[model samples]
Target: MANIKKGDLVQVISGPTQARGGDRGKQGKVIEVLKAEDRVVVEGVNFVTKHVRVGQTQRGTKTGGIETHEAPIHVSNVQLVDPKSKKPTRVGFREDKVTKDGVTKTVRVRYAKKSGEDL
Candidate 1:
C-alpha cells in the first residue's frame, strides 16, 4: 500500500505543476493510486489526450473525438496538504513501539511539520 492512499488530498510540488501553476496548484484530491510506478492521479490536474465519445449511446449522434483528461504524477512529486495551514507539507510517520503479551510491535501515525500537528 502507498504511504499515501486514494482519497487523501494533496498538492503537486514538482513537474509541470509548481509555484507557476498558482491556484491550479493550490489543492487537488487524490482519485487514483498507482503503487508500482509510484504515481497518483489528482482529480483535476495533469491533463492528457484521450479518445472519447461525445455521447456513448446518442442513437445517431456523431461520436466525439479525442479529449484531454488528468494524467498521473509520481508520488514523490506530491505532498500531503496541511489542513490548518493550507500549504503543501511533508508527512512523517511516528511509530510507538510497545510490548504487549511479551510481543513487540510498532504503531505508525502521520504528522505534519509546518504546524507540528499529528494528522
Candidate 2:
C-alpha cells in the first residue's frame, strides 16, 4: 500500500528551503498519485509553467496561454503530515480493529510514526 494518498496532507522534505526559493517546507494536500511513476502531485507545490498553442473552443472561446500548475514530485521527496502535530513524519502501518454493524474486522491503517496519529 502507498504511504501517501489523494487528499492527504504532505510536506516537501527533499528540496531546498523557502529562503532559497525551493519547496522544502511547503505543505499541501495530495492531488494525485502516479503509482507507476512513484510520484505525487501536491497542491501548491512544485509549480511549473506550461505554454499551450492559442486556439478557440468549439463555442468560440479563446484558449491556451502560459499556465502554472503543480508538477509531480518523487514520492520519496515528501512525508505525510502528522494530524496532531502538523509536522512531517514517517508512516507506519498497523492493524486496527473496526466494528461495523456489530461485525469486527481487522484492517491495516497508516499512521504517523512521530505522533502516533492516523494519517
lDDT of each: 0.76, 0.93
Off by over 4 Å in 2: 115-119
Candidate 2 lDDT, 1-119, residue by residue in tens: 88999999999988789999999999999999999999999999999999999999999999999999999999999999988899888889999999999999999998779654543
Off by over 4 Å in 1: 16-24, 53-64, 96-106, 115-119
Q: Assess candidate 1 and give its lDDT.
A: 0.76
Report the C-alpha lDDT of model 1 over 1-119, residue by residue, as the tens digit.
Answer: 24678898898766553556532464689999988888999887787899876765557767779988888887887888887788777777788888999999987777766744544
Of the candidates shown, which would achieve the greatest lDDT relative to the real structure?
2
Score every model by TM-score: 0.68, 0.90
| lDDT of candidate 2 at residue 95, scale 0 to 100 | 98
Q: Which pairs, if any, clash in model 1?
A: 54-64
Residue 85 miss distance in model 2 (angstroms) = 0.8
